[model samples]
Target: MRERLFAAAERVLAREGAAGLTNRAVTEEAGLAKGLLYSHFADLDDFVAQLVLDRFEAIAAEVAGLPERAGSGEVRENLTGAALALLGTNGPAVAAAALSRSAVAERVRQAWEGGAPGPGAVEEAMARYVEAEQRLGRMAAEVDGAMLALAITGTVHHLRMHGSALPDDNPELVRRLVAALVTVP
Candidate 1:
């Protein structure tokens, strides 16, 4: 039920933008009762915050495995894969929705700051992977792993939060950026 509502919210955000987001719209889109959302979440703000945080958690969990793949794949593909993971399904719209409401945004910010998984977790996971690859002689010794992680995550964050297209929509674009950021060993 929660996932269904979240997906409905994503569609609303993507098609109607921030201005049109409302509990009623989300419920209607989900084909659930108007008050069904309230029954699940404390309020609209809680729903929005959970949606954004849940998405971030999903991406972070995926990137958490980056270190394990360090020695097996091409560094660019590994790193670019992590970057793309950060931009999960409907990322841009989800980000826009989070930013559209002050209460929701603050709730997410506080939850992230409180150490729940979020954007920083993705960056940290990538950095760990870079360092692991560096130690394995899979990457150049001169490259700063943390900066590389930042570059990839920052660029991905931009695309996730500001881009109109999904990362999957133009993976080559992300690959290009990742290529530029990662050095050949």
Candidate 2:
């Protein structure tokens, strides 16, 4: 049910943008009763907050599996894949949500305070993958894993914020960025 609501929210966000993301719009998009949202969430802010967190959690799970790829794949390839995944299904929607006023932002802050992983989890996942590569001698000893992770995620975030206005070239751009950062040999 939550997944259904989240998908509905995504549709509404994509079609209506953040300003149009009312509970009515989400319920209409989901084909569910309007009351269903309040029953599951305290308000629209809570719903939006949960939607953003759910997306981040999904990305975090993907990142959490990066260590298993440590020695099996090229480090650059692995990192590029991870960077691409950061832009997941909800990237544009999440970026739109970020522009909303206090309600949604406050709920997100509260969720973070209550231990939701949030954006930092993506960076940490990339850092862990880099550390794994370093341990396997796939990355240079002098490379800063955390800094590299930040650069990748930060660039992805910037591109995501630009959203459909730009061509779909971010994946290749990220791939090249990762290749530049790692030593394949």
User: In lDDT terms, which candidate is top?
Assistant: 1
Candidate 1 local lDDT, 24-121, one digit each (tens): 99999999999999989999989999999889888888889889997897889988888878877688888888988999999999999999899899
C-alpha lDDT of all candidate models, in order: 0.87, 0.80
What are the clashing pairs of model 2?
Answer: none
Screening candidate 1 with a backbone cut-off below 3 angstroms (N, C-alpha, C), the clashing residue pairs are none
Structural similarity to truth (TM-score) of each candidate: 0.94, 0.90
Candidate 2: where are CA atoms >4 Å away? none
Question: Residue by residue across 44-81, what tens digits does model 2's lDDT show?
Answer: 88888888878877888888788778898667788888
Model 1, 21: alpha-carbon shift in Å?
1.3
The candidate scoring highest on TM-score is: 1
